[model samples]
Target: MTNQQFKSTLQALSLPANRSAIVGIKRGIERETLRITEQGRLSAKQHAAALGSPLTHPSITTDFSEALLEFITPAQSDAELTIKQLEDIHKFTLAHIGDEILWPISMPCFIKHQDEIALAQYGTSNTAQMKTLYREGLKNRYGSMMQAIAGVHFNISLPESFWQTLQTIRQNTQPKQAFISDSYLGVIRNFKRNLWLISYLFGASPALCSSFLQGRDTKLPFEAFGKGSLYLPYGTALRLGDLGYTNSAQSALNVTYNNLDQYISGLKSAITTESDLYRNIGTYPDGRLKQLNHNILQIENEFYSPIRPKRNTAPGEKPTEALARGGIEYIEVRALDVNPFSPVGISLEQVYFLDVFITYCALMPSPDMSTQQQQETQENLSAVVNAGRDPELCLVQDGQSISLKQWGQTLFTDLRAVARYLDDAHNETHYVAVIESLQKAIADPEQTYSGQYMQQVLNSGLDNGHFVFELAKQYKANFAASDYSVYSEAEFEQMAQESDQQRLQIEQSDTLDFNAFLADYFKA
Candidate 1:
């Protein structure tokens, strides 16, 4: 879709121009953790005793934007811009948003004595190890004793310098795995699963949460932030800008095409080797070499094969109509983590940070980033994730390495400006507070959640059980006094019944035996 067509469609939908969209993120996974706890309700004294009593504070409290762009126009549909309009928005976002990277690997895992002795399995997904540790035994062992901080992701449009920086990092060379893995998948799954739990607390009907949870054994629920969840909250969505807008049918087609295009591009880039595997894929003393191409092809066919690129259009076809023939457009923000200690499942601080980061991304200029620059961004992001609490890690920007705190400060400075704008434009005071707290965190790194996590670990001796339990305590505290618009007793009963029916429906729909599916899933 062309940019011009896209703008006119927005003029038609009359989507709020100045208002910002917000949604509650909650989860049932942790609630399930609480449900199975043997300790019943933990009293204040009991909570303190569980911790070794170093930094035992009874109470804790916390407080918690978009842009205009030239979107690709899609054909107009249903008197509104169609799906093609959305893709045009993404093209605009891609062309306009800027980003920053944080490294998650450098953070400490906070292993406790129980974790040390427990027979636990690491997840095969990105967050698998933590999930397996927490779900299988940690909840029983720790309760709410854990503390953790997740790395943040900011999507900045690629720029010329961004490419140069990444290329330099890749060329300089380092031995590390690049492909997504079980650990990565686990982290994402846990984080997303928790969002549903939070939403439950946010006044979403029990029916809604339960609907998402059907057939799930563990408390973890559906992936709430489906591909498009992230961008919807951002004020500067692809939905706006100049892009071609077609009728609704054409709009859907455009989104489908874009999604397929991304999948194909990702598959084409999935090449890896023994050096990049979690465990080297090659190096058998007895002899065989790694079949990198075979592994890549397998993933492509099994996973990405389902996606087909949009069919070609005849010459002179309108951008919106042509792309809308097939496709959908959506945004996926991947930086959020479940605030294990917060009842709401995410902190007001975290939410505000996301708003700030996304707004910044929307406003930043897009320069064509090189592969190397992307690698640098990726590496730096990992470092932030893993070592955000560490004061010494250096972040690279404009050809220089600066302390993580310094880099964060610089980022915060920019974010605050955006927050001020959001406040004026959307009348959101919460955004301002979020910016201030982020700035404070940058100034005193220990003040941030990551710092608190390290401190708790030191005081509690990294007991996985203790850490998880303590963290859960904090989570309870965060939401206990706060008003949670939850279902009443009578309402809850109705939802429970509905949940049973939903499960039955799912069971009936399955052709393969449940046990068979389970067998194949676990074996795979």
Candidate 2:
């Protein structure tokens, strides 16, 4: 669509009759960080008893490793309230963990080898064992070192009210749920096309401690930062690039974000398809469970994408089954790196920027992507991750070349207009202003989080490890000095106790043997 046409559509959406429909934009955050000791070594401690059970806790849990803490905030319409809950989670966690501090970045603390990382454990139950076995499969398929890298997932959805209004505006004929599902798929398509901008603006892992490489050979041109660090001078998020969790095997899987049924069918196919490479790892080698089934993807979650259409599943329901049953309830953006500068690992400005971007994707026109176009978007996103700040870099669009700055400027014209409509609907004043700041960051790459943080490392002459440790210490001190604001200490204590009980109940409720449990789960 032309810029003027998109502007007219926004104007209609912002009319008094339709304004409040956009006000119900809901969001949730899932932030992950590794736990490190005072000296910056990865912690060897198990999941602390003071914290709730990692398996059942509503707010706190472990990710791939026991040391990697994942904090979840409930979905709320107000981003400020969501962030405040995150802060309270941080304060309550710090009060319990004695001296260990949360790492301030997406990349992990210095580790000698993958063996130092412990798999996250759940209490012994058929269900819990399946969870661990899935992780074991991940470890066997992709090394544990890659899983150690952390990120923040932004989950968002437009309420039913919003979708209803959108259907009316378009005068669509499909059923409400079907329309919502199709609309969300369009959003995913646009999101993929524009993901490069996100990586350039918020990506923060341009440098890494040399330990992450573990003497592996690489082709990317990386210069030495300090005694024990290697860096790409113009890179944005190395964590989203080849060094982090990758999908080289799934590249040919053809999971297109075209339509809900096709998308679901594509992912399900990978789960049941066997892989000769992973088959060699042996699912039950050494008289013990080494991994899950030797499939291209052991489960739906293993089909790593930067974004996914999600539905809260019923008991024993697979993710695709849930989607087919109820359609898309939300979209989880998995491309974000944990902002090292923010105490909560994501800043309010970042949230606001995403708010504008996501909403614009929903309102704008999105067509089905051809296979060639999908490949181009992936290649463009990879280019930004590896060399976003390089002035000489250009991305391919419609099989033509365009510089990042020029394209971003054009995108902001629509984004800023969308922000104005969001601000009016939400009755908050931050959207337009936040978009302005983000627009500036787009024009000037040095203003991006990765650019600023990497420059600090260069100027301070501290090794990557020492520099991150100092930041982690400062954030720890901040959390320590702050009092609980959103959740009370007593409330947190009660939740931990309740979560433990819930975990025990689940363990006791398991009726099937572990092997039978696996068989039953796959049958679903």
TM-score, per-candidate, Cα-based? 0.43, 0.98
Candidate 1 ranges with C-alpha deviation above 4 Å: 1-263, 268-329, 390-392, 456-464, 470-486, 510-524
Q: Which ten residues in a row have the lowest lDDT in candidate 1?
A: 60-69
TM-score quality measure for candidate 2 = 0.98
Q: In model 2, how many backbone clashes occur? A: 0
Q: Residue-wise lDDT of candidate 2 within 1-524, one digit each (tens)? A: 54565677688789999999888778999999999988789999998899989999999999888898999999888888999999999988878888999998888879999989999998898877888888888887888889999999999998898889888887898999999999999999999999999999999999998889986778989999678888898999999998887868988887888899899999989999998778888645357777879889988989889999999999888999999999999999999999988999999998999989988888888889988899899899899999999977899987999999889999999898889998898887899999888888877889988899988888888998899999889888988888887899999999999999999999999898998888888886
Top candidate by TM-score: 2
What's the lDDT for residue 394 in model 1? Answer: 74
After superposing candidate 2, which stretches have Cα over 4 Å from the reference?
A: 2-5, 283-285
Using lDDT as the measure, which candidate wins?
2
lDDT by candidate, in order shown: 0.30, 0.89
How well is each residue in 1-524 modelled by candidate 1, as lDDT tens digits?
32233233222222343223211111111110111132312111111111111111111100000010111122211111222222222222222112211111111122222223222232133222223332322223222222111211211111223223322323434222121111122222222222211111111110011221223243222123222111111111111111101011111111111123433345434422111222333434665322212222222211211012222345434222333443312123323333333432334455455545543543333233344544355345434433444457676654577776665666567667667655654555877886786567556655554455444444665333344545544434433344313223343334334544543454455555434543443344
